[model samples]
Target: MTLAEDEALAAAPDTPDDALIRLLSHRSWQVRWNAAQNRGASDAVRLAALATGDKDLAAAVGQLGDALSSTVLEAVFEHPKRDGREQLGCIAHDRTTQERLASDPDLKVRASLAGNNEDVPEDLVRKLAADRRAEVRACVACRHALPEDLVITLASDRSALVRWWLIFTRNTREVAELLRDDPDEVVRDQARGVLGEPPD
Candidate 1:
């Protein structure tokens, strides 16, 4: 571990809040993460400043769940820094956070939100089914909580990979319809595997 990392580890909750805030500017990403994790609200505000100032720092701050608040999370989600958006989308846990991530212009950010099993709205999961990135679509297909209609729609996605994911994992009767007209042979095979019958 680097000196920054060591300093960060030292600035746990037991440490004075001021000391932890100062450590937010540490050169090491690990140290920043530690500071963000251990700091109080005031310190977290200070750390957010550092996080928003630099993409690397923002990424580190994103890893610090202990210091996170709905306010700070909103700021991170809206930060001009792209890297921060990726990390923020991964860790944010509230309705506001999910909304921001679902609407993010970056597909990776949206995908990260979809991958998070908690707090994702059903509407957002449906939107993710049409994401340009296959990874995002795959995440949507894997989300078992998605409404049955959304799952059925995703089961016919153009990407065979996404279609196969729904076909094999989803047991909804609605999914059986996709098998009847699946364009991808592999997806058709997977759909057949689920129903124990060949496609027409």
Candidate 2:
């Protein structure tokens, strides 16, 4: 395979899974690395990454994030390759998986759990809402269909960024009213923008 073709294979976001599987074993590490990073990479790719023992490639499996099934994620957490833990939190549906990741030291991991999964349990959502980090709380704010009490609570969040995301959820009338006079100008402006829009 030519370097140019390898580079093209590496860079193309839409590279098919079969091609990616082939590239995972290709002679060129660069092509392999790109295949690992592609969004289309699948559980098979992750399994291959695990087998290859290339830490960076294994870590790139994080890009698959919410796309991964619990079975594969179990493999990821079991593996020592630690870099991708951040994105793996997205698909953590199992209570044990959520519990393991919920208290992880890394905020990116917690934030991914907070924002990425539609099926994330309400209890976990509550825990993430109260996270000390604004980044994690902001991710919670971006979630749709939060419990009503949470809408009110996040509307008054100490972090302006959290409140800003709350405004964008467009979940309740109270959100606009609570933030219309917010101390943060950007939040106030966003609140104004959504004032007349119907709540979702």
Candidate 3:
């Protein structure tokens, strides 16, 4: 079938669920992609879309937001396919899904979860702050409104990058004295900015 015709079939509201499912495997990625994004697409179609591992199509499906069932969203988050899982971690709003992703083996996925998800549980926030990967810890350090205790812990973190973010994201005036002599020169300079001292 012609590209336009294929897309029309994929996107037609009247397209049967089974047919849409079949189109998900059509040779043209656009046809399959259109089928994936069809408003009429079913939970089954959404799950199939993630399994296809086409990053763009998976992203389009993610944009469907609340139109997507929790089961469908969970499937993508837990899918063996890694195509768009990191992006999913960044924007996931469902608490259960966010918790599941918090322990994902991929550091990028966990880091994304830490850097975004405004409603992330405080327990998870603490967990990410101490995460072995500096990148994950760095993300936690960069979040605002962190507890003062967490800020102190981050200020003492071994990774200069994590300490850098702590100073970068928080109002340094509150912790200026703590960070003023940090070993990382850039971090010290940032702390100085808060204290009105020159970067020596």
- Best TM-score goes to which candidate? 3
User: Model 2 — TM-score against the truth?
Assistant: 0.67
Report how far off residue 127 is in candidate 3 (Å).
1.1
Tens-place lDDT digits, model 3, residues 24-106: 88888889878988988788888878877777767767656445787887776666655456666667677777777788888
For each candidate in the order shown, give its overall lDDT on alpha carbons.
Answer: 0.68, 0.77, 0.82
| Clash list (residue pairs), candidate 1 | none
Candidate ranking under TM-score, highest first, comes to: 3, 1, 2
Candidate 1 regions exceeding 4 Å error are 1-11, 21-29, 44-56, 63-71, 78-83, 171-177, 195-200
lDDT of 1 by residue, 2-27 (tens): 69546646455676666666666777
Candidate 2 vs 3: which has more lDDT: 3
The candidate with the higher TM-score, 2 or 3, is 3
